[model samples]
Target: MIQRHEKQIERIHKWKEDHATLLKRIRKIYIWVIWLMLPVAIFFWLFLPLSRNTVMIWFWSYYALWQVWIISRSKTVMWTHVARFFAAGIWLVGPLCAGLLWSIHYLLADGAASIQEPWSAIILGPIVEEIFKLLPLLLFLFVTGKERQLSLTDYALFGFALGTGFQFMEEVLRSWVSSRESLLGMFISLIYDNTKEWGFAELFPGYFIHGDVIAAGHHVWTGFAALGIGFAVHFRQKLGKWIWLVPLFLLSWAIFDHGAYNSHVNLLTSDIIIEFLHFFTGYGHWYKWLFVLSLFLAVYLDYRTLNQEKKALPLLPHETLLEPVTESIELIKSILQSPKQWAATMLFLRERRAYGFAMALKEREKPRQKIYHHVQLAYHLLGISALLLLSFLAVNSIAVENPYYLAGLFDGLSAWWESLSAFEQISIILTTTLVTALLMLATGGGIISAGFTAIGTGLLAKDTLANSEQIASILRDPKSFFKQLQEDAKEMPPQELMMKLFGLGLDFASRRIPGGKEGIEWLSNLQSKSQQFGKKAKMDGDRGGGGREGNEGTGNIPKKTVTSNKGKTIDVTPTANHSTTTSVPNPAKGTPNSSVDILDKKTGEIKTRRFYGPDGRAVRDVDYTNHGNAKTHPEWPHEHIFKWNSDGTFNR
Candidate 1:
């Protein structure tokens, strides 16, 4: 075994040495990608919104090259790192972060509307984006077994790469969507489409919403803040537990800087900066200068930290090779080729540590990519609802001008509105909104993207109400909370737990609109009906010979019963609709000698028939049509002849 292991290790080394030429080619390709992308990016930036296709081409090309460059610079960059970073950024965090920030805008719209500058940029934007951005890094740490391994420099590099990817995608989205039309509005259009017949031209497309500015140095600042947190984490022992406070301060600074940049106003020393700049030159844009200054400072800090770390650890000769994995070297090869299969195996084995490690080995994300998935859902629902309102209004407007449209179900939209009860109106609004959104999703081309945006926007309201501050505090000591949840889950059956959750969801929805109590009550009633049906089904299974193996005579079938909400009960009896000789249900199997009287009341004639066998398949002759002397034991041609078969087959 030892000799075999040595041979495997030697073979691996030989393979690596042989692949040096290929590795060099790969490195050159990365370089080419970067150089090629720069020109296209610059061109797009110079000629803003020239076309959607051009902008997309530029952004993707730039992002791909930028990511490649970042990876190329690192000595220890691996295929795994490249795949994981891109997957986390492009697939997971990017869209979610955008959605989070968008939702915040709508949530705080009323308060923000009062402010001239973008309010979300200052408050909610920082919290949402920063936290969401941090999540990917944390996930990386957890998956890569780097929670303990990561140095401050590593943190800074990872943060920078991740933030760049996230920001680039965000820029692409902004370019694709119109500044004037919120994702919310786009979603609402679904409901409107039902009532109004607007041309395809009126619909907001990628072309109309262009010229989206991709902010420079924005992500660098955020990345720096993350790096500071990583530094704090690294030096927690020396900092005496108070190290955590450093991250908070750094994050706050990052947020303020972001807000200042986005709001286009200096948040810290606006008056002084403006005056100083104005004194030098009559033109004053203090925010732009401040943004530039902040970027410079963040970059400087990041560089200094990385330089110090590099000096301490030092890079390998090539400065870009993976550490030699031992023990399961063959397994590592398999994983590098097919990381997903390795992940599945780990999961199957219930090896948490191995699974996490394996997860970081490829381009895969956690199932819960966005913490604000529910928020997105809420936004989609809301957007659909708003559209429904607008569509109804448009329909009403048309009806007023030309009564032939509605034909009098409504005199106008107002008359129709006035006729509905509060509950009815709310029901119509929600149901119609949901239906419209689904229909739009099914039919529309760009609707999915719009829905994602709206859903992201919807998260704002939830985030505000939930309060990140409170959540942070709770998260610091989440043991008790998690324990409580675990206990609840253990105590409740899955079905009951699901019901409770559904009830809670309905409760949340009800709180949003007037007469929402009706919705909750309606849901409760539905649950009760469902439960009753379940009970009946269970009872049927219990009472009857439930399985094919249990063959009791067919005398145990339960009668159907219906009960109303008011306690009125109705019994239903089964009747034979087919032309077969059907037997009446009894408690037990029929005895061979037992006789039943077949009597015709109109003719006052009676004929007796003796049943034989468990199923009563064999019977003596009984013909009500004959006045007298009906054959007792009839042949095949007789009026009524039956024969029993042991195999449960019948013959007459």
Candidate 2:
């Protein structure tokens, strides 16, 4: 046996040596990867004609793909997957997107009242673009898993990402091909188009609203489509037949929205008599209300989405365990339960300095790369938002200081406005409102960026302070989470303490992942373990030492029944192992009683409490430790634990 043990140790040592050598080789390879990658990244972003916008286009394009990937996730996603998707998305998205731009050109020249690019871009682009953008998702869904539909949120996110990608490509191409002369020439052309048709305004807000509106429409249309598919797949008996109406509805919605937008012809145009025949009661101007209605309806849909997420949140798996886990799902569910309930809980827990749990849960939910990329996006958005806000401030400041340019702009534009003699008053008001809305959206970016920056910084700070390596490891190896839960939730372990730590990061979990109920099983186990461990300590002396006892001669009589032995003591979770030392409490407070009682009222032989050896086996002596620090409260100087080595390190 000794020879066998020696051989095993030798083999293990050899394996360690080999592993160390492998690690050295891996480091050497990393040096080469750095050399290879840096130049590639730089060149791809600089020298290549398309590379200037590559980061914007490819990054966001991949981001769009990632939305699909996450919703359609068969497994965990990683940076490698993101990179792969970027490469593939760019390859496929480029030509198709180019075609969209050309289609907008021809469609607008054919459909518009005047020859204009931006106006035509706005007028014909959206309707045509929606068709192209919706194709990839539709085909992807059909070929892969027809009936495995997405939730409305994911469907919306995916549609938006796709449209954003298309927009990115369009922007890149526009920037690439644009000339100063072209932009200058388009001013008159664009105005002509806008004068002829009002749809230009709808398309002009393409920076954000373009993707948003189309995503709204697609989300509604395709969302309905997916809902139908899901119904047919999952609950066939009731909804399968009803589901068929989705595509028809999709066609109807597109046609109606398109026709409604196309039907607008200003009263000054050649079609005014036809417009008067149709909209004699001012339907041309009233079309603005449709756009407003559409925007609000989209917002309402989003609200419903959030509420649906909330409803599903509480249903997340929790409490079906021996001890409750400290997953963020529970925390978020609690938050969503009611603003007041969560507010009180947050205040209570935060006041107690129990923030580690939230950090832990955040760490457990999001990995480093996801966090890094998200932070990058946030910073980019911050930059854009800040610029917009500053621009507005500048414009306002300029108006107050100079006044001449504002006068000139208002005069010139107002003259153009005055040209619409019959439509002057209503057009001015509508255009002004449109301008105001544009400013608001641009400025709103600042608000969104600030929100993200604040949340990210706070969460990151909490994670750092909380020592997130433990939780990070769990996220890295999800399969190990259950094992960690079991290990952390043992009776003699710091189950509750770990639970508190995990609780701090709950918000992070709330925003990410599905199936809160699945995650809470481990927490339930931890909770159960806490109760057992707490009960064990409470029942050490047969549960009789419920209150303070002053006498030196301890009562030997065992209790007749199990009872609550609640004491005014802070039982800490284990911090370090091996040393049987614990932090002490106030000497003024009564000592905790270690007693045991019979399980039932009808008892057998009297049971006595016994201490165990370091090996957790039978032993006689109950070891006492004395560890203390100068920071200890002066009033409780003598009560502080003082187990220290010669070096002054607290020997646990």
Candidate 3:
């Protein structure tokens, strides 16, 4: 019966795993579906004679459904999924508050509508929008209990969804409230009405003016930034305990970025920059470039926060790609090294887990592999960025040509739009949108192909050489590399011979120079004086008095001082608890030692001692906490060791 119960438990666990995998695949399918059907959404949303509000409502509803589907698959219970849907309803409440604020502002002001437009965009909009966007997040926090339970990525997505919903309604409200003609309609009208001798500048302005905010823009970016700040606050224990200033700093940055984007301050600030561009490139209105730059910064910062969180803890639902790599390395390390070395290495690996142990191992492997990894990262970054930039430049260049080829294309579009019936308009728009997306993709793919060809040729040549004798020179032969690895495992070593060369002359000069020795002596004296002060203070406190000049101690206090290397002095002080504390200097040549010692005063024996090197790293530690006088049994003594970067920062 017990065996049967165990089998049933195993079956349930297996079922859960299968269900999770199925959900992951389903989520991927849903994402792909959304992307593939985006052009369909764009076409219908633009061309259908349905009320703009209705179209927006449908769009939001579809997105909300996707969000609910995601939450359902989050390994949460049915009640949690249902709660998510209720939390999402808070976005509906947001716009109503925004509407109330707008109405109040309109009724209370004597300003013209033109004045109010910029005022609303710059001031009123960000305030109302950010406040309302935060409401759903606050509600999520209140409902979720401890904020630390949810991953930072999850909260970021929550804020993004909230901003998305608000952005949709806000955009619809803009379209509904505006008295001006639709941007696309005006552009089409301009093409037909001014068919003869049209000004390219007039056509350019229409393209810049848009009623709907794209999902990739300010709203989502700001929301992620704001939530990142909140994540830093709530996960301070995991992030960095007592670092309250970090979240406040992030919050300040988010508010400023949102305000700048909404107020079009990027454009305002770029006028001089644009004029400079005009002076050289003969075209300027660099506001879009500024906007894109700001968006990139926000996105990059959010990515950094997510990266830090990923380092601190495993991301939910998906294991880190490095986990398998690390385990594989450990399995290999175990096979290669002696049991003692293997144990030490395992301890070292655990200590450095937060610092990406797998990546570090790859770094220390064959020099060729390190080069390949670096080149791979560089090529990927350059290839993606350059490809996207070139594709967009190609598209935008064609659109904004001096003769206005895009305007001429719109002229043709006007004729087609007029010729088509309502149902036909939807079909044509869908086809055109898909064709445009395909063209852009094809252009990007072509550029990527050219880039990869060049990059591949160089990499292939490098790899060929790396596999042969050429890389031996870079890593200084295999024997030396293996020796270096062996030596690194033994202890926290000093600067390499080449690195020590620079400091060699300096140390020699310090030894020979008159003032250098005097300065060291002066620094040593200063340490002694500080110790004397501390002793006096201790005596005064013990006697319950407050006088710098205390009675001379013959038997009352014990004091001992040892100075070496004409460097910093280490004071070993005795306490009433029969313990002594001391600092040990580095005995290694060309390495300054900074260490402390604790001893059993009565035995005149070392109880515990920690040895630190020139880089201020505790290279070795010995604690006799459980040391026994009986020689019959041995104690398992150990030291927590660390490796250092070239610049003196410890690995973990």
Per-prediction RMSD in angstroms? Answer: 33.2, 23.5, 24.6
Worst 10 residues of 1 by lDDT: 396-405
- The digit string of per-residue lDDT tens for model 1 on 382-490 reads 3443343223212100101111111111113354456556854444344333222322221111212112111211121112123224334445777875676557555
Off by over 4 Å in 1: 1-75, 101-117, 177-216, 265-652
RMSD score of candidate 3 (Å): 24.6
Top-scoring candidate (lDDT): 1
Alpha carbon lDDT at 606, candidate 3: 54
Q: In candidate 3, residue 62 scores what lDDT?
A: 32
lDDT, residue 80, model 3: 24
Please list the C-alpha lDDT of all candidates, in the order they appear.
0.36, 0.32, 0.35
lDDT of 3 at 149: 40
RMSD versus native structure for model 2 = 23.5
How should the candidates be ordered by lDDT, best one leading? 1, 3, 2
lDDT (C-alpha) at residue 531 in model 2: 43
